[model samples]
Target: MFILPAALAFYRALRVYPSPVELMMIYQKTVPEPIFKIVIELTNLDVKDRVEGYYNKFPPQSLGVKVETRMVGDISKKALVLTKDVQVGEVIYKEFPIVGALDSDLQPKGLYCTQCLREVEPSMSIKSPESPVYEAVYCSQACQSLAKPQHHNLLFTLERPLPPQIPLDEITPEKLEARRKAHTQFADYLKNQAYGHSAPLLVARFIARQVASEMNKLIPGSSGIPSSQDYAGADDEEYLLADHIERLRYVEITPPQEELKLITAVLDTVLPGLDSLVTEERYSTLLGKMAYNAFGVYYDGARDDKPAPTARPEDIERTRTPMGTSRQIGSAVYTVSSYLAHSCDPNARPSFNAGNSQLHLIANRDLKAGEELTVAYVDVAQRQDESVEECRRRRRMELARGWKFACPCERCEREGTTVGSEDEENIGDESRVEKNMQRFESNEGPL
Candidate 1:
């Protein structure tokens, strides 16, 4: 390991003239380990550990970039800021993760590789005869193998009869009961949180898998996943779910009983003679968490030869199932990407790569060290005139209704003056609203 004196001097030289060569020189002189391995360790450590390690190794002034938590008004905002200037179009980070949800209604069956969420060539897809859900779709043998664990637990076909269809005008008691029963069974199976029937269930499974993976690392020669009987007693198993779900943004209002009842009915229907596998409270929490955190999965470009759909263009917006494209094929929660805070004017942008099931975060402009990276939760570029008040109104509506936080961003502070310090207001300027009818557009910034 490098000593403090060596590290400090190396850091100072790099600060004065930062380059790949300088970095390599410092590493060669001080680090006995492979430089690439050290770089990977630095990049992949837990955010807190990474920040602390960097600060300890070199003065904060020496590192040109850092990810830090800072107080913004009463809230703590986690931002990825530059310690040095970075050029526009530079990729800040990249992640490849399986999507939690894909709209089967929009995408043709077998369009995506199950494991990586990458698009599959129809001719290259593998088929499963035994499974109903995944019976005829997979991008490759490798993806199928990679997805086997999650699939085995969550993707079994139920040996049950489908309820007979009844015409809408001739509704009957028997039909209603059958429909209810079918839905209940679906809910029960869904509660297992296996392959992400819903975003929340998928998120739950993601959390569980991560916990199990970590546990395996700590305990050798044994599966890290504890049996249900041992789950409660296991260390931090429950907290993993609690912590991740809590990160979702939601309004502080209580869910209605009707919704709760609907969820309870489904749990009851799953496995008739057995006890319900999911509790109503847990189900409710999953629903709440999903409401705020799920990301739309879409083909990055047009999916076919058809003319663009009537909806807004993809280049300027995040549209699910955009006009000519396959649109949103599904939804996902990229755990790390969720940390980015919303900004009307942002310094970073997220672009999906359908080919590899990856999310790429690109610099929107030349960013100075210490400038926080941000992305607009809603379309910031869609608004033509850039009326400050219109932006405030739209942001307030989204925050109050969905995000459950009062934004104190510079733009919000500027336009929210007459609307009261804390309360959000509706934007009544129809003409201004009409100018920016699209949602989630990213064209306005310096990308």
Candidate 2:
């Protein structure tokens, strides 16, 4: 188990808070001391056991790959290293997402399974008429059953939020109305305002999943709602979902205040005090992580008729996809696949061969054991009409604009000399991890 440093204990006793500069994006004004104190307490509780030897716990042999730390200059990066030699087109592993969300445009249309994002024939799909605010349809009974217990009931339905073993206050008519109103408001907010962004819904689903996991522990002989357990190891018993999420890298994001309020309101209404699980700082970090790590789920060759975005270029949401976000039907975040770094010429590519959110890692070239697996985050293939130099610039610009990172992969390095100065000014890496995560990884104290 990871241990907290002595310095962090001292800081906790002193009640030291993060500086304004560190919180500017998340908070417009000074956070009330009480809320800030809650943030500090939550951080102290979680950071103690998140990072040290965390990657070692994943079952590498079963997954056919291991996560190893590599140094790119002074920065420590995690990479997926193959455990066995494989040829092109070989399947390395298959993973289910911890949480998945359909694209905003498709969510209300009932053309896809909200649980798996699988395309559904209207006549054959199962619809949830009980959902007051969201129109959730499933392709199968299994999808509907898994989704309701995991998150759908808590967020979208009036069903009991906790297991029978757990006691609850009487559900008065007033309480029921309040819960319905909160769910309706949050669902309407997502439908009317979320647009291209799937991060908000993904974050909500993740939080609900965590709550469900904890609640399930109250009953005997229950493993809780299955949450991407395809390769979980013995250490999973000791680690919570929060432990897995806190270690991943995140880009900074400033979500709207109303979004948080709507989500927290729903949680608080369902189970009192559950809203405390997500503070402003925590919510922002969760959103950033989801946005950074989520993969676009597409099938076949991907679609070409996605609607053009009216949002400004910088405001448009982008998921990690070689096919580009426009072509994807939905987005999902996988625990293991999150470690697969980007390459202009990748050794492995993520494929949704099952026509759902499940990810299959396919080898692009013959490889030896210990080779680092990589995938193209943005479309990196040279277009038929574009020159090599032009292709390099286009991919680099997408990386910079979408992920805030300049490519330093072997392919980019070889072509760097040919790219001229005209595009150099526009490309740069501005990506960053959360401050607490950096401190934890570096064996320092909490902020």
Candidate 3:
């Protein structure tokens, strides 16, 4: 039996990091209470306190945090408040940490760990046994196993070849209309029977799965559930109806009429005339729900601006900032994440981690105890570099175009200035940032 002082001294002498498993072994073997205390102190944790804290904040298997409603001007808005103070770079929340598998022949090859989205060596990759679209690569077998349960179905579907790439230049009105007709037929097929899976639709399917999972949790005896949309099951039918009504009440807004047309188009393909199955009002409301809450999902190695010119591709691939350095892969609606409202100058930012297919809300700056956490819908990182008028105009235009809201951000309110360009402004000018995003997305493909 080693003395407490001797054990502590031995622990201090070891320069290498110790795994938690090793620490547990040492903890169990330590005879003296003082040596156990030393181990606890070294780990920087009070297990009892941590266990209590977690149970106090959340129910068993429940996600933590609460949504609060507050009045901004005359409108009541929802915001996600932190249950505890988090330090800088600490993740407040993480959701959908994994996404659809990346296509093989994707550029910046083997950039991310298939499991954790951590950068992995190309030499370290292990291929999925028989996957076609995904040459699934992971940091380790453990990661591959962790991803298998949630990702297996999608992976099997990707065993077929991906459709041919569409050129960005060929997105003309005529071409779009033709594709729309073909897509409508495809949607009908999807409605009647499951055949093919597209990346964007896969994201929607993922959201439906999440919604169904949440619904199952809320209901009794819903174990071993298969699928949930309207008419999937009696329990699911009730949940879907109640969920939409609840969403409307939570957001406190009516569905925008303009978005209904897009909804109609989507429903035509996915549900194949299911648009007429539901009431027009109900269908429109669902579209509005999606429009208001959906977030753009991005994956690792999507950003071109992140890597240093001399940085190796592997080094560049590791960058996973909350606001993302790359183009978006797809969009999905989250029940809890949707509570975060938009701010031009945000205190928090959302980062999509593809490893776990989760979105993490990170602190952009030090936050007070009760600060309503806000995230920017538009990238406002360049505000400091640009003029106030330029910032205001850009934000206003973005808000109008993307969010369907006028600029009411603190910066816009404070600046109260606008400038217009006399010449026709080409928004698509091939700037360095634009070029980088295009190159990265074109090479890697969307999430």
Give me the candidate number with maximum lDDT.
2
Task: Provide TM-scores for the models.
Answer: 0.55, 0.84, 0.47
- Per-model lDDT: 0.44, 0.77, 0.43
Clashes of each: 15, 0, 15
For candidate 3, write residues 165-275 as lDDT tens digits: 211233446544443554444334333322111223333333333332332332233331332121211223222222322232111124335334433453333323323
Give lDDT tens digits, candidate 2, residues 119-208: 999999999988948999999998998899889999988999988876789999999999999999988888875446889999998888
lDDT of model 3, residue 193: 20
Q: Candidate 2: misplaced stretches above 4 Å?
A: 1-53, 193-195, 227-236, 418-447
Better of 1 and 2 by TM-score: 2
Better of 2 and 3 by TM-score: 2
Candidate 1, residues 1-447, lDDT tens digits: the string is: 334433332322222111224345445655554544545344344334422443223212332444466666433445556667778998766654423544433233576765556777778778655454323366776656444433222223232211122111343565445445644444354444322235433533453343223323332233333322211111232223233333333322244454445444432332221113233454454554454455555455624432343543211212211121234455555545555666766778767753544666678898877788777665544367657666667555554444445555777765565865336232333223223321111121100
Residue 174 of model 2, lDDT score: 94
lDDT of 3 at 323: 47
